[model samples]
Target: MKMKIQFIVLPLITLLFIASSIAYAQNKNSAADNRNAIDRMTKELGLNETQRGKVEGILSAEQKKVEAVFNEERKKLQLIQEETRSNLQAVLTPEQMQKLENKMRQEGSKNNAQKK
Candidate 1:
């Protein structure tokens, strides 16, 4: 029924999402990278303190907006990930599930280490 379908689809979705996030992270331009653009503008334009302050305010506001959007998307992704894990438990054999859980834990730790 619906539950069986859910279990079968869950693993595929998880794999797809993991691959996509890896790709996205590799290609993404983070807000920190904006520092270079800001600096370049200041140098090329000879911005005075007043103009520089205005530019900083605009950039800061834009960065906040980007962060807000990222957070909203991340929340959705977390919900999907949780659902995937719950459904996968029903479909995978106990041994298979254990292997998957261990792999996920390893990857999680690796990601944390990389972040630092």
Candidate 2:
């Protein structure tokens, strides 16, 4: 069970975490949050129309660049995780593989319940 967790459950959880992070990074609320931040900054600094516009542009560009990087990295992480699972499958016997799958499903269910 320990080895099953170390080899399978941990990686599965990591993949789930990374997937959720990617989803959050791509969430539309990020744009709204950015706008709110800029609005606060403009109010506090008494920025002129032109200054506010420039600041918004700068932040929007920065956010796009950061999101692109995050998406690219997330893809790489998923590929690595897939390869790890494949390799683990190759190493384990059929019975062990079934057990690992069952354990993974249990863990996934537990995580989902916790989230709810």
Candidate 3:
């Protein structure tokens, strides 16, 4: 039971950390980053209005694709996390599961506070 808990919880925590980091990065940069890239290209390559418009469209499409991919991956990760938690609940006693929930909540609060 202990080993199973460790195995499931460790990977779940790792996935959550990775997902949070990716979300934070996406929120921080976003569309402005795309516009900045286009601006840089326009300046460096001396692109005309038509070329600039095309590049903007390309960037916009790329951003949408990337966001879609991340969203899909995020949904998959969430499902995996939920499954792992359910499995853990099956393995653990009620008291142990409650303890685990409290620990996770505390950790989440710490993470949220740190982010602020």
**Best by the TM-score measure:** 3
Query: Which ranges of candidate 2 are over 4 A from the true structure?
Result: 1-16, 19-28, 98-116
lDDT of each: 0.68, 0.74, 0.79
Q: What does each candidate score in C-alpha RMSD?
A: 5.5, 3.5, 2.9
Q: Estimate each model's TM-score.
A: 0.63, 0.70, 0.75
Tens-digit lDDT track for model 1 on 1-116? 64465456645655555654654563366555667767888999998889888998898788778767766676777787778778678777778677777766676556657655
Among all candidates shown, the one with the greatest lDDT: 3
Model 1 spans with C-alpha error above 4 angstroms: 1-32, 106-116
Error of 3 at 52 (Å): 0.9
Question: What tens-digit string does per-residue lDDT give for candidate 2 at 67-104?
Answer: 77777777777777678678767777778778766776
Model 1 is weakest, by summed lDDT over 10 consecutive residues, at 18-27
* Candidate 2: C-alpha lDDT: 0.74
Candidate 1 lDDT for residue 106 = 70
* TM-score, cand. 1 vs. native: 0.63
Q: After superposing candidate 3, which stretches have Cα over 4 Å from the reference? A: 1-4, 20-28, 106-116
